[model samples]
Target: MSEQLMVVGEITAPHGVKGWVRVRPETDLDQLAGIKRCRLFWPDNKERLFEVEQVRPHRQIWLLKLKDVSSRDEAEALRGALWMIRRDEAPPLPEGHYYVPDLVGLEVVTVQGESVGEVSEVLFGPANDVFVVRRSGLPDTLIPAVREVVKEIALNQGKIIIDPLPGLLD
Candidate 1:
């Protein structure tokens, strides 16, 4: 039950001048659409709660219509707004998947029990996510989050067991 809020989507631009905005969602479109209310984080560091009026997929992106935004100007004003939700309210993830917050500071080690470093960040790349591991006196390591490299994710132990592919940790 973390009180932290996580961003799920962002308003990219106004869609058709009908007060509908194009949204780039981070999670499943269905899950994002199911959310009745959300916290909108504005570009100027302002936050407000908004009710979802409508949501529909348009090509690859989604078009979202929020309550009280019935004009093109109103929708345009929310150009860089992020759609946030409570951590506990996030949609359930599939098995073996972990949220970014949970993986961020966990210990990283090899399958043979060799200490590597701690996960400082996760970069979502085009192919897969890369775990940025920071060590004591060594340069940061970039470990690709693949099944072959990420052997085990022991969240209960607060560590990630990896089987690095030869030059991966270098």
Candidate 2:
């Protein structure tokens, strides 16, 4: 696993006057449920750990109450803040499953070992995820995150093998 801290959610806005903040989760609900404490990363790169007092599902986001934030103003101050957890503390993935963060920056290669590019982004949709591979001066390539297209992901080697469909690179 990488040594960098992983962002799991973001404090979107203040909820009620009781220091609760609306969080847009980046991970699945099951992963969100396992988070009891996390570090709040500010824009200045400063981070502080906070204990989670309460967590409940909102419409499409989550409402979280941190232990120290006591007022609406306090929650408002936390706007745009990011919630992060240590890579080691993140929930373990099931067999054959990988975290999206782990895929970013991995070198994408063809089945025959042709260099494509590096993964710049992962777009999650209702059906599946898509990886945006970027190379200098070339348009980004979108690869579907499926078994047929994504042949193998060797995180330890920092490489991904993909079988591009017809016209996928165009």
Candidate 3:
């Protein structure tokens, strides 16, 4: 997809017999509810534009009614189709909050400037997010995302500075 677009959800399965499809949403309920336009990515990198007709919470997932998708079979054919929006259309994030997509793949270093690894993944835990750093010839290092541990995130510089606990890198 273009850099201007970002994936916000995915069609998991067909909902009711009508056009509604189950969506695994990456955006919050409020944001998803406010979406009017979405680009659905299909097989072979093909895409189709859809006007969101309705969105409603259904247990852990969401039911989305898209214009032109008026049958269960139509919705079923869109299974695994990714829902995307222009990045500029996304709601502004609060200060100190970074989007998951923005955080991944950043270089990680220590306060003293020791190269640790690059961020391989960000695991969301009940307490906080964990940064999984992958270093060469070593097991992945799990760094807590607390303020004390993650001292600085220089997105412009494409790096992160961490104040590791004793024996953390050993």
Per-residue alpha-carbon lDDT of candidate 2 for residues 1-170, written as tens digits (9 for 90 to 100):
46678877899999989899999877655565666788998899887899988878787788989998999999998999898888877778777777778889999998989999999988766788789999778999889999989999999999999898888887
Q: How does each model score on TM-score?
A: 0.79, 0.85, 0.77
Q: In candidate 1, residue 144 scores what lDDT? A: 94
In terms of lDDT, the best-performing candidate is 2
Which portions of model 3 show Cα errors greater than 4 Å? Answer: 25-34, 53-60, 167-170
Give the per-residue lDDT of model 1 (tens digit) for 47-159. 98888888888876789888988889998988999988887776677787777777889999999999999998887666888999999999999999999899999999999
- Candidate 3 per-residue C-alpha lDDT over 52-111 given as tens digits, one digit per residue, 9 for 90 to 100: 899888877788999998999998999999988887776667677776667779999999
Which ten residues in a row are the worst by lDDT in model 1?
A: 25-34
Of 2 and 3, the candidate ranking higher by lDDT: 2
Error of 2 at 58 (Å): 3.9
Clashes of each: 0, 0, 0
Q: TM-score winner among the candidates?
A: 2
Residue pairs with colliding backbones in model 2 are: none
TM-score of 1: 0.79
RMSD of each: 2.9, 2.6, 3.0
Residue ranges of candidate 2 with Cα displaced over 4 Å: 1-3, 54-60
TM-score of predicted structure 3: 0.77
